[model samples]
Target: MAFSADELRVLRRALATALNPAPLQGEDVQDCLRLAEAVDDAVREAGRLRAFLLADLARYREALPGSLPGYLELLQDALAAGYDPAVDDLAALRALRANPRAAVLLDRCQVLAERSVRARLARVTQTAVATTPRPRVRLLALPGGRAADEPKPTPAPPPAERPVPKPSEVFPPRRRPVPPPPPEERAAG
Candidate 1:
């Protein structure tokens, strides 16, 4: 059963008091803990019930035919049941049919979903762009106050100096460095 607003409010107040208290009677403390656990269990059960209903609805839609009248009736029922037909009912219908009407509904649902996604993506893109630093586009004033699009002046390179030799390059060259003379010294060359 759904929790009434008054009951939820009372529970919230009790939880807040329990959480903030320095001490309480053992019975009161136990009651608070028990109530909290019950609330959690109730929420879990509600979620499970919702999921079961959705699955059953999907199965029902899949088993139903896709004529215009039938589709309209299904849409009406779904709406009356507080389901979003575009997002929820249409997907179930798509899984059920190869008919033209089913294909149309599927296409419509996809378009709706795409538009919703695009809107969300646009908002995120806008937010990201707003947060990023934009490159400064400076206009150079030429002689006689004419603005010119000259290439940006690159910073001068550091004064050139002789490159230091790497460790390997600095080392003495070994023409075919003896192959580590052999474990046994050959008879005096």
Candidate 2:
């Protein structure tokens, strides 16, 4: 959610009040409530914007592979809305590389995709260390309260570790070529 500087300041003050409970004046209470409502409104607006952008991206992604009218324009709009190109997008762009417009779109998608990945990496690096490992707590019942027929707790099996594929294996340079049409079918067509 996007917040103005004033809103953020108000939010910080509200949080401080919450963390340290004190008798607040009626004016302060009303201000805090108003700020909370404003924050909620901002959050809802952001959510709506996000949903619209995602739907737009999906529409372009689906249309790009077809010979639909305005698909190219749709692609440009999607890129502007922060669409992350997938492998399919790359392949489609490659196929359409002969078209100058497609080439421009391809270059834009490549740059956007690289920037997107870098931004994600930056966020991950910044917040990764902030996550503290949660302490595992075991609950025990009252002493001498064991049931005679109660089954013993079984240990969980360790998770199997799958080997990570190399980037080359994961993302091949090209898809397998389409097989040639059969001679009989080709002649009929």
Local distance difference test, each candidate: 0.65, 0.77
Displacement of residue 108 (Cα, Å) in model 1 is 12
Clashing pairs in 1: none
Top of the candidates by lDDT: 2
Residue pairs with clashing backbones, model 2: none
lDDT of 2 by residue, 114-187 (tens): 88889999989878867866688898665455553577678999999999999999988887899999999999
What local lDDT does model 1 show for residue 142? 59
Off by over 4 Å in 2: 1-24, 65-70, 118-189
Residue 19 miss distance in model 2 (angstroms)? 16
Q: How far off is residue 136 in model 2, in Å?
A: 23
Query: Which residue segments of model 1 deviate by more than 4 Å?
Result: 1-20, 66-88, 91-157, 160-189
